[model samples]
Target: MTESWWRDAVIYQIYPRSFADANGDGIGDLPGVRTRLPYLRDLGVDAVWLSPFYLSPQADAGYDVADYRTVDPIFGTVEDARGLVADAHDLGLRVIVDLVPNHSSDQHAWFRQALAEGPGSPLRERYHFRDGRGAEGELPPNDWPSIFGGPAWTRVPDGQWYLHLFAPEQPDFNWDHPAVADEFRTILRFWLDLGVDGFRVDVAHGLVKEAGLPSLGRATEWHLLDVGESPCFDRDGVHDIYRSWRAVLDEYPGERIAVAEAWAPTLDRVADYVRPDELHQAFNFSYLATGWDVESQRTMIDASLDAMGRVGAPATWTLSNHDVVRHTTRLLQRNEGDVAGRKPVEVDPVAGLRRARAASLLLLALPGSAYLYQGEELGLPEVIDLPPEVRQDPAFHRATGQDGYRDGCRVPLPWSGATAPYGFGPDGGPSWLPQPASWAHLSVEAQEGVPGSTLSMYREALALRHKTLTEADSLCWVDTAEGILTFTRGAGFTCTVNMTDRPIEIPHPGVLLIGSGPFDATGDSVTLPPDTTAWWSN
Candidate 1:
């Protein structure tokens, strides 16, 4: 692997609580992940990005970090985390863990001290604490709403309010405090010493806020993250934080990198997070948010590559994550938004899966790194029918409607077995989020060696990408029929995706290497079925 292996790597995301369970406790832990190293290595990913497993009360599903250095008891001990990193390294795969510097669990020692010591304590300065605005000081300091739901400011018994951009259980940190910034640098070194390769900075755009903690004036909308008007998120000051962190990562031996989960409104602003002296890569969310249309996809692709290239950073592509609806279900519709509390919309499952497969091929064939969410390789769709009583997402509990609930995508992965637990745990214990009966067929064992299964397709494409596409430094567009996209990578590699209604002949003639769906070839042309993508090598 090269110093900048992440430039064109395929990284797999493992949502710890739902990945695999070694203990009969029904939740996945670090030891379980260590045991699955071979599976990921075999799947052909260059790296594995583990979501938060830090000590927490599980509010916001571990995104609320109580201790940056301690592993949660449910996830495993510190020794287990060390072992997972060592084992992953032995498999020749890089490890990238989640770092949530924007907020901390309310149960964190700093938050506890701030609460006990009242408004005047130095600990209180590390967080946002202010007096309420009403005549009796009863109203919140500001009208900003939590991204989860309701008010972002929570008042304490002592008449002071603390800000939390997310759920109340997760308090936003004050980046202006020198101690807060210094503390995160210490935390970064703690993991780097353990031989981990990098960190995925969660909410990377939200470290700083506008000077004044002013009211947003209007009812808050969660989709406003990229609007740049919010006082709480994506402020320009956040880049300084990354610049300092980059200096720390540079001191290490391997080219340890930082990938930002930033949601800036424009590609140029998102690029700011990955400027030569700052973080390494920022997720190209504009591409993920785009609907399945040629024009929309093409525009976002061009914009992302252009902006990130200007900054000398590789663009990162992602299709799904633990927080939102899976793309298989998302691409079935013409709209792009969360699928929580809304009435279930009808979709042709067959068609949705087909489009998802095609989209995967198109994304992998692009010129930068790609992230694969857990369970997506098996063609898992969102489990929208979760019973209300068992749902544990903070978004569902705080909001009146389904706009924020993300539990459907966090169901435990099925390894083997035909029943409910599906080998997720040793004793087949009940999963934290119930798996749909339909998942019996989507289990890893069910699709492992099946030639045309989604799992097989991903493995083959990823292997091909590592062998052929990784070294291609440029791509040239080839004119194609309306609704079809054709581009060549280097001189011999061509990728074509047909989005039109009818089968269209591939413009470039080359030996068929792999495809998302069936294709037919003659001496001069190849016919691609509708809603399919193919890779060819001349």
Candidate 2:
């Protein structure tokens, strides 16, 4: 890969707890990921982005980090992390680890020290410790709501309240403090010394909050994809932090990079995180949230390209991640009425898979980086029926305005076998989250050699993309019917997606390279079935 390989790389996100288990303990570990390095290499991804594996109390699924330098016992030792990086590098794959800088676990040494040192201690200044309002100081510092629901502040025993934008157990840091910036510099050096390729900055837009901790002045429930401006997120001050971080990353070789998991009000605003001197890439969430229609997709794609182009950075595209519903289920439920009503929208699994397959083709054909969640290649649908007793997403307990059902997307993958656990761990071992018995038909073993399977489709598509597409960052929209979207990337590559519900005949573009589903071609035109995507060589 080139020095700017990330410009058009395919990065896979590995949610450690559900990816693989190496110790027979029903939990995924770094050793398990090391064992799968060859599999990822063969899958055609240029890098792997791992979610948090740091020391944590498991609140918010490891996002509440206790120690930035230590590996959680459930995930193996620090040596295992080093080994995984070495193994991944051996396979010519880069490794990007998650860095949760917005907050720290309540158990973190700094947070613990702040609590033990009382209200006036210097340690308390490292975090957002403030006096509350009202005559008796009983109310929170402000009216800001947690992204996970409820107030964003929690009172301490010493009559002071600390800020936490998600859970009380995860206390927000005061980026204004010099200690916070100095400590993160040390942490960055620690991981860079460990040989990892890059960092995925979790909540990258949330480090800096507006001064004075002002109130929102109105009640509002937060959504994961909320684009509204907030005093607590996407502040201008955040860019300075990334610029400093970019300096740290530049000190290392191998074009070490950082990708921001930022949720901004616009694609142009999101591009600010990826300015040449800031981070390397930012997720294009607008494209991910777009509905399954030609106009919506086209507008978002054009907007994303334009926004990133203005900054001279490559646009990144992703459909599913651990935080939201898997696209297989999401695309099928797009037309479901009133998602705001929080109704349990019924999903048609067959139709969902069809759209998901087409979406993958579209994602890969785009002229930028693409991110694939762990089980997306297998076409895993959201396991929406997990019993409440076994659910672990903190949002569920918080009763957030959002669906709070991220567990449905994080169920353990089905590698083999026909029963529960599905070979996630050792024989007879239990899984952290139960897999559906129906997953027997969706296992990697089940789809390994099956023709027309989603797994097979992804493998072929990725392989073809690398072989045919050039480094040229040009994409031109081709004129097509109302429900069909067609574009060409560079000279010989053309991709088209049919969003209509019926077969549509169009003039044949060129020799068919691959397609999401079967199609019939005559002398001058081809019949594309409903909800299909195809790639051709012009």
- Candidate 2 structure, TM-score to reference: 0.98
Error of 2 at 74 (Å): 0.3
Each prediction's TM-score versus the true structure: 0.97, 0.98
**TM-score, predicted candidate 1 vs. hidden true structure:** 0.97
Residue-wise C-alpha lDDT for candidate 2, range 1-538, written one tens digit per residue: 4879899999999999998888888888888888878888888889999999999999989999999999999999999999999899889999999999999999999989999999898999999999999998999999988888788899998899999999899999999999999999999999999999899999999999999988999998776777379999999999999999999999999999999999999888999999999999999888888888889899999999999999999999999998878888888775443222132355888888898899989999998899999999999988878888998878788855355788888898888878868778866588888888889989888998788888889889889989998558489999887789999987788998999888888889899988998887547898899999999998
lDDT of 1 at 96: 98
Distance from true location, Cα of 397 in model 1, Å: 0.9
Instruction: List all candidate RMSDs to the true structure.
Output: 1.7, 1.6
Residue pairs in collision within model 2 = none
The regions of model 1 sitting more than 4 angstroms off are 224-228, 336-346
